[model samples]
Target: MTVFLRLSAAAVTAVASCQAVGALAQEVEPSDRATTDRLEEIVVTAARRPTTFQDADVSVTVLSRIQLEQARIRDIRQLDGVVPNVQFNESGQLGSTFISIRGIESNPFIVNRAAVYIDGIPFRELSNAVLNQVESIEVLRGPQATLYGANSESGLIVINTRAPTDHAVYEGRFTTTGFQGGTSAMIDGFAAGPLSETVSGSLAFKASTSDSFLRNIQPGRPAGEIRENFLQGRLRWKPSDALTINATAYVLDTNAPGVFDQEYLPLDVDLYNRTYAETYNGGRTIGQFTYVNDAPKKTEELETVAGLSATYQLAYGTLDAAVSYRKLSTDARGLDVELTALPTSAGQDYKVKTFWNGELRFASPADRPFNYIVGVSHYRQDDRRFLATFVGPGELDDFVPAPVQLAEARDWGAFFSANWTPTALPALTISGGLRYDRAHRSADQTAGSLDLGPAGIFVYRDASLSGDFDAVLPRASALYRVSSQFSLYANAAKGYVPGGFNLTAAQADLADQVLRYDSETLWSREAGFKWRSSNGRFRLAGAAFYIRADHWQEIQVATDEEGRLISSDYIGTDASIDSKGFEIEATAEPIDRLTLTANLGYTDARYRNLQLDADTNVSGERVKLVPEYDGYLAARYQASNGLYVRAEAALTGEESLESRGEAIQPATQTIGLQLGYEGPRWSARLFVDNLTNVRRSSGLAFRNFAFGNDGNWYAPIARSRQVGFELGVRL
Candidate 1:
């Protein structure tokens, strides 16, 4: 309603402005249809447009599907150490796996730590990019607010999925592999064709199942199995060269039949951490889609997105209109989740649904000597959660008499930004942006669905207004074209993640003990270069960057001890955290039959200034889990005999990880080896992941509180290095 009126008015004003500007502009050539694959295009998407990997002044890694498959990257969890600056952490068993890009990454569903996107869509959930369905994955380092928005303070991991094509097509693939400690099988298919003179549609689906990787940690325990299924389709209608309309729909489902548990082992014993014990069972499902009209003059996209944006190209710049809507829900069940005085009550369910965000963007075409971007955005969300509780340990088995409590929230935000490139300075660009957010949360202990006295509600509502926040970020960079194939550039930018409330509200009776500190922000500076040969046979890129983070977010230790689902806390206010790194990659085809590629990266992340609760000043604290070095080397050999072979190796450095102030997992490195053979109609592969079985914890690392006398929480978190073999023959 009112939102629509505002958008339409702005749009009309933009059209008039564009028409007027074009009347006085200089002539320029329309870009030629790029001959190289678009996927190969150096994505400036990280910055906003197509800038060479190096020319744009950002450190990044671009992994295409071909490379991923060749490296035997099967699961999202398998990405550990595959690239530098990537460390993983998972809790709540195998099914709820969570990975961190570098350290201090955010949980999209729980906090504002990092930002994730799909296509041009800013999607918060990283798990939705069906692994097998991805066309490419791009990792962007450092602050990205000049182009992308929100929580892009630390970094961003973008997935570009396969898209609709211009020609008709049919394709399918099936694979089966035996892992040392597990079994996995998969089938995927896709088709695209014309339905009429003006329309075409594409359909894609993937299905897979894998047995648990651990053995018998618990006596008589059986292996838990995990399954994934997905179906996504798109229909596009092109009525004219200038007009295209597309509608999309998708369904993704992940069901882990049972829980994968940890076995406790004593700390002093060698090979002490090893448990293939299986436990629990549950699942979850999420679905969504969108409709878009892309015209030569303007593109209109309507999405059920976390947020939305609609922009019309204008002569001076583009004018954007936007909106957003969202809803999320989760349900997990079974027995005990962890060793605690409290057990996740049986038949008890955990859930969160109803949250949405919106934003708009406008930018001038970069072709002109001077370019700029301006936009505003908003967000609103509703989260409702409930858990079960019992009287005490003795009566716990019988279940509690009723629902323990309910948590709910309603939040709002607004933001604006602009990027300017002076007309006379063709080699320089400057950007600036700002944001303001307001959030409101309410909670209740239901006596029966509607209960919670007035005072309880007041405290919740008043506390929200008590903590409003605002931020301002500015950035600048320049690219000096050293040659047609080379360029030098440097940039400095600021990015921040919004603050959040504590999980459960504390009563005024506990006043003076209330703690409040908005989380940290990341500021980064980077420099790099780009080069390519005229023959397209050789390419190279490199970049160096440093990031400083202040007030890093963390789980509040005191809150945890007080018994809450989650606590919010910021650490090291007196000291800033710093992560410095460099990445370089080269691809050269010396001859028609041979191609070589390699990428190397190094990142050093540590705490420089850490102030723990005013008195405990722990400066120089090393951020746990982030490795200092990682890289991959690969080669592809093709023969006139119609066969191709690829060999690759990846290296990951070790790090010291601890929990509850006790050293748990030590630094270790795991290497991977892959051998593949491909021909006209057949292919086969043999992969040895964790080939060294380097004993590193795969999930959360901590001492086992439940282990029998001996103490190891993560015994078989990771396999003792394993191997997998697969073969396929086309009909």
Candidate 2:
């Protein structure tokens, strides 16, 4: 990987230098007025204050709408290796997304380690429609506890949507993507304009569907597929000069066919002879010693969100308030592959979640010598789930209902942040923030089983548990300007992940141990430098960071020496993991009609003194889901005839898949190309992604067993060698 980076740097320098000389010969000198103009300043609200990116003492990455469209990114999954130190995989069992940032991972379906927000409303899950309707995305890679509170120990993601305008605006787009075994079609449109002098509204919608990638060798089984539809609307009113009100609503509907587990022949066939087997599912044999089951699996989900925000001018500053409500429902049914006794047992589950959030804030004037912001927020969330497994005339001869669980959580927090630049030190600035959060969590679960015969129903276990937690988080930072175009900054921050009650605790005797997991703490120190050229055509940023984390909560699965399942436990490790890394990002247009961009990230995260028990000491092991290095490089060229071409390449480093370093996933690289033509009102593009046809494992479920299912895994093979065409028109 180092060699690749060196070669790429040399090639880019040589080509850009040659092009610069040739273009300079054909270009004219800038006029006096043109020379005074500079690049448009990038504004951000990372610290709850509006400021230029170059003036802030934090690390952040911003992607504009134009950049997203140029990359042909349709969903959050496409952002996998594009950014530094971020890994996102939307392909997994049961249609769940896996997110990891800076060596901290979060489960999309369960507890969260990071926070995501759209238009100031917290999003518990990433819907399929979010990426297509947002105007910009900000990735802040650090503890955001001062403002975001719990669940933001790793980082935060902010999304802003395009609002209504005073003048009428509208656009429509159509696209088609084709691959070896499947094809997809998408249609999207948006319109925004004013209905009255003081009133404006905007609307956007998208509809898309795609065929499946895996082809079932057996007949009469539908291929795994996907379908989604989304709609969003917004209204803004400014009846007075000092007051403004806004309303937003969005809805998403999605259907997806889940993992396709295939079976193969084991290396040692003799082990199967000793295994027991039985006939089930209407004369079909079911057991670890038998052939695989080819049953269909599917998932369907619906999500809706509504929010309202109001802002009013105060005598000395500004006041803002907002409230939002969100609801999500999912229904899934699939074959139970892990249960070797009943290969055809149907596993069905239903889940429903609701969330409510509100906030009130006030801020002093930005130009004041001492500026400050204070805010209070409240949140309430409830979840209900039911699951059942039907044996369907197997040896078990009964339907097992694993338990119905109800979980509820409520939290509130208050924060205060201040910034100051003393009169004696005009070129130096300091900032500090403090926050306090209190939370209450509870869970209720019931377990049961039903006999198919006249034996009747049996209830085994029922229990309830509750807990409360509170914490105080703080942050401080300083920045010094060496010159107008360069600055140095350093910061120290603290973050934590909230404790929770586990719903899987069923045994009455062990309920106390299994029902509660403690919160974890993380402390980080970072320093970096920012630089920009006087011409405003070149920009560079870099950072070095070290993090110390303790009491990390992890779910570990145990098995016997023969690889047979024993138990899965959720516990807080007594050990610690230290993480250190550096990042570099640069953008330059050394020659006219050409632009170049590159970013590199490196991380070294490992566990120290990790002793699960007196007999087990697995220290110095690499953290799961964290790669050593990742990077990307791209270049684009535009001609005077409205034609453009761009090429990009991205790489991911090798990493272990499990905590004990049992399974290893190899490194992989891919390239992309695009050709497009633009006009005043219309544009068209043809693109090819994954030109190298790389097939790395995206998700894995493996164990060393005689059955051929050990090596079976799931990957988005449909995206390989993809050919796509897009057309757009504005009105």
TM-score of every model versus the real structure? 0.74, 0.85
Q: After superposition, how far is residue 565 of candidate 2 from its true place, in Å?
A: 3.8
Residue 547's lDDT within candidate 1 is: 80
Off by over 4 Å in 2: 1-40, 91-94, 108-110, 128-130, 214-217, 257-293, 338-342, 392-401, 449-461, 505-511, 566-575, 609-615, 699-719
For 1-731, candidate 2 gives per-residue lDDT tens digits of 23433443443344334432222211121211123334335677756678777778887777766567666776776766567877764434225555667777654334556677888898755544435556877777878878776777877878788787776666667777776667777777767878899999988887767664443222334555667778999999999999999999988888876423222222222332233222323333322222323344566889889999999988889999999999988876554434233344445567898999999999899898789989999999999987655544332223355667799989899998888998898788898998898888898877564221111122335658888888899999998888888989999988887677765422123434555777778898889988889888888888888988887776553344444333323455455788889888887777666667788888888887566544776678877667788898989776666678989998888866656665566777889999997655557899988888765545423453222234432122224567888877554
Relative to the unseen true structure, what is the Cα RMSD of model 1?
Answer: 12.9
lDDT value, residue 616 of candidate 2: 72
Q: Which residue runs of candidate 1 sit more than 4 Å off their true CA positions?
A: 1-43, 72-74, 77-82, 92-112, 215-222, 260-328, 334-349, 389-467, 504-516, 533-535, 559-576, 609-617, 659-664, 677-684, 703-731
TM-score of 2: 0.85
lDDT of 1 by residue, 152-209 (tens): 6767767656666655544445555555556666666555667788887777776666
Q: What Cα-based lDDT does every candidate model obtain?
A: 0.50, 0.67
